[model samples]
Target: MLESLWAEMPDRFRTIDLESNALDTDDLTAFLTDPRGPGFRIRFGQLPADMDREMAWCCWRIAELGGRVPVGVLRSLIRWLAATVEDHPELSGSLMRAAPREWERSIAAAYARRNGSLPGRFWQENVGSTLRRCYEILWAAYDQRPWWRREVWDPTLDPRIPLRPHEPLGNHAVYFQQLEPLWLRIAIQWYFKVSLETGQLTWSTVAGPQRTALQVFADWIAGHDPVPPPWLREDPAGIRAFMLDFLSHVRGLITQSGPNKGKPLSPQRVNTLVTCLETFYAFMTDHRETAAQVLDEAGWLRLGPYHAMLWRHGEKGRRTRVVRERRQEVIDDTAFSQIMSNVHLLGEPIEGGGLGDEQIMRILMLVARTGRRISEIRMLDREPLLPLDRLCGSTGPADADGAFVAKLRYQQTKIEQAPDTVLVDAEIVAIIDEQRRWADQHLGPRWAQGVTPKYLFLGHNMNRNADKPFPPSRINQTLAVFARRLDVRDSAGRLVDFNRTHRFRHTKATSLLNAGVPLHVVQRYMGHVSPTMTMEYAETLAETHQREFLRYHKVTADGRDLPVDTRDLYDMLELDKRTDRILPNGWCLLPPRQACDKGNACLTCDKFATDASFLPELKTQQHHTLQLIDERRQAFAARTGQEMSPDNVWLAGRTQEHDALGRIIDTLEQTGHRTDSDGRAVRGAGVAARTDALAAEHDEERRP
Candidate 1:
């Protein structure tokens, strides 16, 4: 790596001599006069006599560590390094010894001296980028410890994501050095234990907010007037006192950075701060012996039951509050239509107020059509589309034509055991195919062999091997700007906020349920680990429910069309919220204040009502009822050598139920609600006939 950087330098600059601590004056003169070096000597004269050699070394090291650097940036880097060592000699002798804060001050002072104030753009382009590159190299070289043992863990090097190095380190690096020494030690060991030893979490989660939470706790501890001790290892009284003070301290704190700066910390933020401490203490207490041995301190054994438990029942209610406050809005049909119609604007040039992204529109299309999580879609493997027959070893379910169906095995980034593969229609497959072609055309040569790129969507910068998936934050930011520019709004005139891509997941799930798809099927489609989690997305719209309810004629006990107004019946039943009113085969139409005196004989009750949505349940119940009647009649005949009387009480009830079920089924079949075993509508002539009837009815309604 250094060879490429040293190619343009003279022989003396090619290698650092092990015996010489500093470059000789002649060597420095050769470098400054070299045609390839920064072609100016104005700043060179200001360099400190004792530290100029070290400053020159930084310039060499940065070039060696980073990609091609501009001469201007190299000049700025030299100036920054020289000024830093002159002003803060103790912090600047070597990049390896410099701390984050020291480097921070060095850059600020250097830029301030030259420009009066540091500008964000110039700082990033010149000083920040150059320093980060040099420091990254220095840290990699200085820290010879195993990753788990180091103060900073770079998740980009993790084998699970082989191309993480192609992405920026700021997003993936976890710094434990900011913590107090003791807490740092505990945190390092705990992170190692959970993330590597036990495999409790993947780095995606452990390296993110969890790491930030720990750092926040560390900062709080460092800010205490008198340094705080390990109260978790202290006696019960000390533990209690420490926790009370910590909680109060955390609650009263305000945000110090980002969009929420100067505002009070949210309840969610407070919970995270407290929860991290609790998690840390709980882990230490559970594995006290291991922690003690690892930290080389017997004090860890003092962790007790008091340390193991932190908050009492109901104490951490902010999580519940967060759930309660969460707005899972489904992008309504009008909004969805508006977005899709103008989706081409997303790929338009940025000068035209668009994202100039080629992949985002396709990505959003996949998410909407498949109901997949954005991460799952973004991290899709290159060959995500598998033949349905290959995945299941047979043709798919009868309703799905296998040739037009494919299994999309997305990267399961969140829940471990959740379904990773979902059966997708040809429409979704076409989108994936389009993206795959784009990746292949763009990234084929980047792969060493004929192998495909690892991810369907590749990162924009430094992704030579196509290892890193496109950044998720890019999608969010682009979506936000797009929505604002397009002024996309719903039917109610509220802005359709598409920034949270998860809302597409919610929208898809809700749409499926309202379209009469079964809950368990939706659960599998949405990759939900539990039906309850899937339920969270099941916000059924009343208009959809009413439309579906009114689509088919409802029949009563004797197979006659119900006389009541369907809209009034819908309101009277409160079908959306009242699950008790919803029965297996049909809805029980008894008023909320009225008792059902008819008991289980709902089929015989005049108040029972149902339509096409209940056709599947009705068919199953009718089949089962017929089986029972036949079995009982056969048993009576076998015992007495005579057929059971139709008037017998048990026989009469069975006949009535079987007859009632038969009548309901016949009525539904007549109205064209007949379906296959899978509940999919019979799709040939019956569908065309119903379509024509619906059109005619729609025309009549329009006229009236």
Candidate 2:
């Protein structure tokens, strides 16, 4: 049977025996001594007389898997298997009859004994691959399952995921071999493959956390008191009880491996496990016939509406809570500046205190400057930059500072209708230009062959056609390492967490809104499908407003100290939550329930208040009010041939506004250079200066 299977496979494998599953001593000698084969010239004369045929079969299997082990390494693996079977005697049949744990123990023993002529460490390292290949090939041949039903499902082998030649294989394989209950494993394989085909789950999700979630469930079920069999026996009620128990079990799980070994499973992780369980059962219940066909059992027909609705009631609420709790933290200006300044260090060698990749530096620069999601940046096309004139088909107006030079159309992976293009400045254009040159040079021969690279940031290894983009994992891992090495800290002195690149997106959105960019414009810039998603960043804006508001001491309209604490009033009035209370000059101190009867006479109303941050707008307002009084007085003189009376209603109101502005300006200027309670310079101190410069520029632009 093994001979027929070997003969039927693709010609990648070398033949062993045409008539028998096992090769004798002469057959093994002839195979190893053959000069036409993979040149295994070394030999082992001493062998277990009874197990020699099994050893020969193992070697032939290894060769079928394309492994070229040295003769010494091959002898060590065969000797270990022979020694293990001799000691146990239960595993004396074919190598595939033993479990993985048994093979692991024998391999450990071989390494310990320095089995064969190889050194102990060398044997320790080389024996694992030999045993693994032997087991993989034996199991594959024994089962003779279709590609999807096999232990490993490679996406590249699937016709659904478009293939590229010689590209580096990432986490592309979904392994079902370790999962328990043969029926459950086959069912998951069917659901996963079908999900990919139907566009329900992406290949990335299947190869990543979806597979992990399934594995967690399988491991849990294997250890359950009523271990799941190849065919489930539970009724709907029993299944519900079992599922609830599984949820609790998953909730109590502690990480047994990896960096977070001792920590409890996080809420996000627990949610993923529960959601996967819900989705799998729902799939199984919906397609009972398909499940039954895959499992080759009628037991799956028992799954019905009850099992399908297991997690529907409360799963969405739990997911929302987890999402809300995991809101991205916005990186502030100080920390962001420090990060950009030290970003070039990422290109230095790892041993030289850097992340050790020049590609990472350019990628990070683009991410920080563009505020694009990491996925968008990673999957950018080879030519993503277009000049404004070229994009619009006409020369667009350029500001004096020339801030807009081109438009960048990144990969719109998340939202279908969201805008993919963003106006970029010269700096961003330069970065894209630099990357384009680098990518073209990197794809040297391939570019010469007229094959255009698929991505701007090409994968570094095994991608001869430049078909694969740089991996997102590399960019994230590099950012983490870069942060740790630089010890980047926020204003609170806590280490800046760079693990989630989406924080950059949050920071960018917050900064734009604070700079007074309209909400609709910010929504478009973020490529959000709705304003609601962009409004999440408004919370950061509220924090900034409150911080600035409390930074300066406040005075009443009469220039007297406030009778109440400014912070207390800010909270009691809920000023941060009230848009109506926001004034062009400062803030409205009126209570929410109170009706404002003071039309345009806010200057005389007791509900009005001003702070140092409003000094620029106040000064501008004061100049306009005085200039208006003079202009009106002259216009009245020209019409009636006499100056307007001082008691005129309009003139009187203008005088009141002018006097009120003077009082506020005097009070603020007298309180100049004041700091907050922490003795830090107030954030609004520079606002006044920058606003004045902007106002002066506006006045110059309006000059006759």
Candidate 3:
């Protein structure tokens, strides 16, 4: 059997190159030397007459000896051996039995070596620490049978949440006592995959996203919101009734707003939500379908209607499109700029009490400039953003890789390339230097009361380890917000602003894009896996809005030199110049401002809303412009495939500008002087009035 098995094995493995492949070459030799290879040990050529038995015996022997070879390597060997020796069930079982223990030990060892200590491995050294708590997860140590649990009510429903002991709560209690550590580990692992893949360390994986969503859910539970799952019921009345009762308890933690004070559910949080929902839907669908098939054969829908009612629909039938329309005001550039200006940086005082504004600004600027995500930054070692010369190959700052590894070596970030890069613009470098000087002045060893944390930024409190860096969370928590408490108010004296440290980082990326940088370049600057990930910035273009309006309009030095494509590029503008929507009796769309310099009076000017019908035949040429827009949208979507949310109905159309076009139209309508009547030609007016109105209307409608 052994001879036949070896003969049947793929030729590639027969002459395996352990050195070339992702395998431990030395370890392979160690396994070959172990008793498992041949018990008493024999050359490969001189192997036993019964090679199959010899192989099985070798694996068992390794287990018996507590194999020196890594479990992963051993497992790999076993797979190769199993495939080669087809009739080796007993040997495979032994390898499987011992594989996990070895796997865990191997990872643990990596962390320990990297961190310089086992405990350091758990606290700060690597990405593994973020997920070190996951080591607590013992899959087999489940105390109870697998049970389906749902979100349960929490009695702490005041506007202010009350603290509770770990012993009591809802369904979370069991998880808290038995699985908290394990869940944390799982979250860490999940964060690891997503962060690495995204090219930006973020809690975008299910484990991390779920943690945030869970907190939001918990908050809702505490607040007593009761919105039922929409898919649970089909009838509008029933759904609404359930929603009304459940809305207070619905618990909305919309991460679309970005994370709050604590760690945010990564943007991948939505991806996780969809994936989990899809999985659940799949399982439930299959189960229900099978049950229904059985029930239908048995005439169950009528005879046992209750059974049918529980599932609501058949498996495939349950796949319904949810068309939820959102109503959000378009954020014009003026508003966006104001919001950003009001954002407090490191220098500003924390008006209501918080970290200094400049400090918060610096943090946000670093995070945003390098596209370092908020969560990733929280897990980072506090340090000044410095030139590469200062980062590595020098004693001034800890070596870049070494410092990052020690501070934020997460499983997700366990690579040569760190998600957070510390490149500083010349201006920002000046800011950082200023901050360091201030720190040296006020937080120096003599002025301060206790041993200061080694981190570049720190709170008043001393760090747990005087030698180690400050806790990422403690410093960030105190410094993340100052402007939010001070700024963001409406004329009515209500808070209309939503500010957070990460928001600045997000805004920085947005500003870069708006300043006319290429999407792909901006995506890279932000360290996003793809340009699409960067689209989540609030500056996303709507269907009616040109998110890159300035870029499109401004002729760059290169653009000016490039050969003009008069045929395709200017087709729309050309068409707009020749005609109007309909001829307006009053004036042309383009209004002259020869008399007055400032265009303020243009709002009440006489020529704003003229009818376009008077234009000879301009509207007929609109097809060209619309075509360009369509093409642009497709190109955008294709480039950033996942950038626009699938749920964004307007996003489905050409250009995000189109999505918020209503506002643009409002701007047109409110401008200049038009009759109080519907948008039309100002009939019977003098020739000047008619011409002026017509020109202004045409220009406004045609402005891209």
How close is every model to the real structure, measured as TM-score? 0.64, 0.65, 0.35
For candidate 2, give the lDDT.
Answer: 0.68
Count of clashing residue pairs in every prediction: 0, 0, 66
Which stretches in model 1 have alpha-carbon errors above 4 Å? 1-94, 97-124, 157-171, 188-194, 223-225, 232-234, 253-272, 318-328, 351-353, 390-403, 440-452, 539-704
Model 1 compared with the native: what TM-score? 0.64
Positional deviation of residue 701's Cα in model 2 after best superposition, in angstroms:
58
**Candidate no. 3 TM-score:** 0.35
- Listing every candidate in turn, what is its Cα RMSD in Å to the true structure after a full C-alpha superposition? 14.8, 11.5, 25.0
Query: Residue 27 in candidate 3 has what lDDT?
Result: 27
Q: Which one is best on lDDT?
A: 2
Q: Give the TM-score of candidate 2.
A: 0.65
Instruction: Find the candidate with the highest TM-score and give its number.
Output: 2
Output the lDDT of residue 155, model 1: 48
lDDT of each: 0.66, 0.68, 0.36
TM-score-wise, the better of 2 and 3 is 2
Rank candidates, TM-score, best first.
Answer: 2, 1, 3
